[model samples]
Target chain A: MLKKVLIANRGEIALRINRACRELGIATVAIFSEPDRPSMWVKQADQAFCVGPGPVARSYLNIPNIISTALITGADAVHPGYGFLAENARFAEICADHGLTFIGPQPRVIAAMGDKATAKRVMKEAGVPITPGTDILENAEAAAAAAKKLGYPVLLKATAGGGGKGMREVRAPEALEAAFVTAQAEAEANFKDGRMYMEKLIERPRHIEVQILGDSFGNVVHLGERDCSVQKPSHQKLIEESPAPALSDRIRKSLHTMAVRACQAVGYVNAGTLEFLVSGNDVYFMEMNTRIQVEHPVTEMVYGIDLIKEQIRIASGESLGYAQNDLKPAGHAIECRINAENAENNFAPAAGTLTGVVFPGGPGIRVDTYVSTGTAIPPFYDSMLAKIVAFAATRDAAIARMERALRETSIEGVNTTVGVCLEILADKRFRAGSYAIDFLPQLMRAGVS
Target chain B: MRALASLEGLEGRVRALAAAFVQSGLVRLRLSRGADDAIEFRRRASSAAPRVPEAAVFSANGAPERLYDVIHADLVGIARFSRPAPAAGLALESDRELASVEALGIRTPVRSLGPGRIVSVLFDDGAPVEYGQPLFEIDRE
Candidate 1:
């Protein structure tokens, strides 16, 4: 058994992991940057270490400092709580090299899935539906040819990416060249890999992802699917719900089976998510995130399983404690990411001290957050301040509960997307589960007054 | 002392002042008793301190002329007896650095009370500064 675990991330995810560790009778060491020293996660941990300055590169992303803190603190394992070095292969390698268990997949698995093109290829081989596209294009001519083959309204994506960065959509031959060059340059600048690939953009598709957990022994099972279609260009997920409302039972089962097969094929171990773009009955694998997802709470609430605990168990050489038949979705759950950003201001990050915080609490409402009254929301990190998730016996009930929760929720000092989330919940398209990936952006563009 | 006010009330006052300061950049005013024994005011400075400047001199008036001359002479000596020096010997996390005296938007020279590292660069340009608030962090190196 690992005696101590160091959370190599921050915010709500870190607090989530700390809760799991505390329940499992495991000690936790929290690593925080200067601005995060006063955060709830830092105070909740058994021990805390300062890794570096406020900038992510100097602090959270400084793998060497994180590992050193873990070593100095005598932590036996490092749990990267999503983002930063969570999916970083080099960080995992360093953890293993230091004889500290990395509570995720092996470095190789992270490396394979970290590259978008390679993950797609692997999933394709595993009989997963993938968007039709070409290999990394060599030049503008190759990109143009690939776009023609894939049809217009195709997407130019970075081979090594996620988070909507380095992605461009071209609707016609006239726009293909410019989109390709711009995307390539962005890819090179962002990922240091100028490699770009073309894919058929599934118009008006819903973003659905399956949560999968496995152990080193090849046992893989999916928790369920989540609908993350309501998102802005900033890639901030506005709303997510489990059992993806419109997905039929047949499609859900198929998606789960495909997700499990993909995990088994890759010999994946630990908590991971397989993302897909769903349009009508067709589901295409987009990519696999090799870390705990930001919206894991909904699945946890509906499934009654502690995913972070499972991750720690798997990393500790323990086989999955539960079988596939034991897992069943219990209730409908929905999550709204309350970010400290001004939706009317192009989602610009809002920073200031949180003068007041009122989180809704009742049966079935779960809030995962590190903020408190008087907490200063530092501007150096992601703008997400809290996640409000609610559960009920049915989807409609859950939606209503979430709406109430949002109304009851308040955070002063920073302009947040709480108002926007309320608007989305009341949106007829969203309520009817008919919204697409472009729903939030389109609604914002129309000016939801 | 006046009756204590709610945070919202204080925040409203801060907001009003901050907005006015931002709009005008600086405002100088003097408070005096008029012939009718009413408060009179006049503008003095073009800009308010970036943040509320420290009460350098605690006298009913602002800084005394002697203290002002001392500050104008050996700026480093200000750290020794400055009304609000940096907190010393506090157990801070590794990532925390000493506040940057330069970044607080304060125009005055800031000397280290003892020793510390630069943690956050709150302000970039030399602006007016608030006193007693965190400027930076100093870890036991």
Candidate 2:
């Protein structure tokens, strides 16, 4: 077991790791940027270190500084909590090289899964259903031909890019050339990799993902699925639910089987989520997120699993204690990602100090957050402030509990997505579980934005 | 004196008093005017001093003296404190070299930023610093 773990991230996720460590009888060290000096996570940890200034590149993302902190503090393991360097294979390798265990998969697995195109190829070879896409396009010329064959309205994506960057939706054949150049340039600027992939666009697809956990003993189990179809303009997910409401039993079974097989094929260890795009009844692999996801709380709520703890146990070379039979999604769980953003605007990033806050609490309500009253929301990082999730016996009950929780929650000073989330819950389409990926955009057209 | 209800409350008061008095090397404060509840702050003199952030304490200094960090944050390595200040370490009129911190890969000079001298050392040469941690103090040099 890891005696002391260093959390190489900040905000709510940092607190999340600290809580898990405390329960497991382990010590935790928190690394923070200057702006996050007053954050609750810092004060709560066993030891705290200021890594660098406010910017991510100098602070949170500074691998050398983080590693030095772990070494100086005698931390045996490092947890890259879900963001900054969570999925960075290089960072993971550095930790290993420094004699510290990284609380995730092996460095090789992270590297293999990080490349979208290579990951697609690996899954396809494993007999998993992948979207109709070509291998890494050599250049824009290759994309042009691939798009021609894939038909119009094809999507061009950077194999190395994520969060909607280096992505272009070409509606017609003529626009493919410009879209390809722009995507390659964008990818180069952001990821320094110009390699691209072309795929047949799956329109109005429901974003569904299967959760899996594997141990070093080659044991892997599926933890059902999460419906993250609701999103904003920038592909930012706002809400997620477990058991993926309205999914057919056949589709659900297939999704679970495919996810397990995908992990087994990759020899994956530790916690991972396999993302799939479902259009109509058919599902296809989008990409594998090798890191624990933002929506993991929904799965945790539904399955009663402490994923952070599991990640630690698995990294220690322990075999999974539970098999597929021991796990099954019971009832329903829903999560709302409350961000420091203005719903009235175009979901613009709203950064300022939080002067007042009243987080909702009751039975079946869990809030993972770092900010408190008087916390400054720095502009140098991600805007997500808190993850508010609720659970109940049924999907409807969970929705009702979440809605009530959202209603009771109050935040002052900075603008939040509370109003937009309320609007989503009240919308008839959302209430009926008939909403798709376009739900947030449609709401923005008529509602807050 | 009224007893402190909790150590947390007492510690908070002591740290608050430290920030409130930058000119005085020692800080003493009472809880309220009506109550004789009072506390004195103590400093553990070492080579490296856990710096109370300059902004928090010096904001009340009233003097427009610019505070300088003797240690630059980006230099990563073990920090060693130099000899104790020559003058009871107060009211330094100019910047002066205080210590030489040498790590395996880097060497840095710890200098008194302005007209201040070493008030106290927070840690010995074997001590290590995270970003922005203070190693020494110069008081009215």
Per DockQ, the best of the predicted structures is 2
Off by over 4 Å in 1: A138-144, A158-167, A174-195, B1-141
* Model 1 lDDT per residue over B12-105, tens place: 7545654454334244322334332221122224222222321112222332211110011111111122333334454334433233332212
* Per-residue error (Å), model 1, residue B35: 33
- Compute the DockQ of candidate 1: 0.04
Tally clashes: model 2. Answer: 18
TM-score of chain B of 2: 0.46
Per-residue CA lDDT of candidate 2, range A296-331, in tens? 999998899999999999988778988999986788
N/CA/C clash count, model 1: 16
lDDT of 1 by residue, A249-361 (tens): 99989999999999999999999999999999888998899999999999998999888888999999999977889997788999999989999988999988887799999
Angstrom error of the Cα, residue B118, model 2: value is 3.7
Chain B alone, TM-score of each model?
A: 0.24, 0.46
TM-scores of the models, in the given order?
0.76, 0.84
